[model samples]
Target: MATSSSTLPSLVVRMLRHGRLGPGLATLDLGTGAGGLAAYAARRLGDQHVTSIDVDPYLTEAASERLARMGLRPTFHAVDATAEIPGHYDRIVCTVAIRPGTGLRTVLGALHEGGRLVTTLAGTSLILTGWKHKTGELVGCIERGGAEFMLTRSGHDYPPALSELFAVASDEAGDETGTGRYPVMDVANAWEVRSMLEITTPGVQSRYSTHDRRRTLLLIHADGSWARAIGEWTDPPTVHQGGPRRLWDALERIRGRLNMEGALPLYGAHARVTPDGVVHLSRGQWSGSLGEE
Candidate 1:
């Protein structure tokens, strides 16, 4: 049976044990994969307490076999987890990344009050664990580091490749371009921005270079956008960009405010999930959103 790295299973186990599951607690393992979690939990919490689900029948079969070998028997189901999760779970642990909108809402709804949820958001594999404080309110923080996993298959995966969207647009010709400075703040890091844009607009890519010449350019598009800059407050930047929004401008604005305020915060950012699977973020004066098929 396929299994996550030893470290992840161990970390997950640690987190589960910390949460302290016992008799009468229903545990659901979404995207059970090889059922390592189910097997582990069954051994700790008892076989009848664990129920695992995955979209692939092969994975389910493998997990069943693996768990049986471990001398534990847990119910296994093969169903599209993104569509619906059967029964409520006191502790719902998703081994896969969840898309925004309905998929996210569905998983959130599957938890009982005060139920614990540990899952990954798009862009980063860092686990985010939270408890249902109340209906419509889930609070959690991201765990340090990252993990790599296949995306849930029910929705659009990566945005289209960058090569597919490379084209000369008549409207882009002779558009005003200029150089600018971007002073990054504490919370808004380059990796986070790039990851967010890549997931939101997959076609967008970036290259950062700093040699004798210091420069930063943010390129964006329908597929997505990328930003690269150099000099790091040492020299002026030479910026060139071509896309729907002035990519450099957005970066500079975010950076400038962060520098002045001493913090670049995404927390409390207003988020709206559209029915068709789009995530919109708005906070105070800033607003942006992305759509996916």
Candidate 2:
């Protein structure tokens, strides 16, 4: 079971302020692991309109008890949000990241026509918010900042870690060695840049570290793709790429595109979710789409 129910204070404030959790709105807290957000919603929306759920019976029971200890009582259920969402709500806030098209539809179906939902996608840090429309679509924009939530789970634990793939990626002889076009930029720390790369070439994981005067950047993907770059602070680094995809090449291309455009696409972009739950994002002359599959 994913323990994503506890919304941190800063993010809670941000979501409440930026996500438009208006007064007296009936809200559903999807994946209520520790019931923090559920309790807050109960205080704001009244317990009658607050329904929290999780797939873990133990989590739901504990969360139910935790809410009662605060003298706040809202409905709690051990239900799969992607399979069975109980009642229609004016605001459905999900803590667990969901696959976009297929699983997202399940959450949208539980929202009232004018209601809204706030969530991030699995493996990326973009906080997406959407408003349900009478036309059977959800329209909104990505929040300026992002969040990472554990994916909702049906079983007690996730499938085995990707350690086996990582093992081969660590020391495999990469296919090419060349001078990097850009210096080892702070790719991982820069959320916007990292989020863009993750969106475009999904599943590439990155790490950065400094040893002596040299800076290193490592990229690995579950699909046997890997890249390594080593350079000084101001110099172009040497790069090696292995497996099928050119992981570092993808990052460099995205960097060039962003440098030319002068901005990240996460902010002020139009987000349109079709009936099938595909989220289309566009701004000015640029566009991107993310789907569950």
Please, what are the lDDT tens digits per residue for candidate 2 over residues 13-32? 56655546766788888878
Estimated TM-score for each candidate:
0.65, 0.89
Task: Name the best candidate (by lDDT).
Answer: 2
Model 1 segments beyond 4 Å from truth?
1-7, 14-20, 124-127, 133-136, 139-150, 155-162, 166-176, 180-238, 252-293
Candidate 1 per-residue C-alpha lDDT over 1-293 given as tens digits, one digit per residue, 9 for 90 to 100: 23322236765675565456777788987877667778777887788879998777777898899778878898898877778888888887777777655677777777887787766655444455667765455665444444455556653233343543333321233244455564322222354554444443443444433445443333545633333333454555545455456555665655566568764434444444433435555557866554455
The C-alpha RMSD in Å for every predicted model, in order, reads 6.0, 2.5
| Regions of model 2 farther than 4 Å from truth | 1-5, 22-24
- Report the error of model 2 at residue 234, Å: 4.3
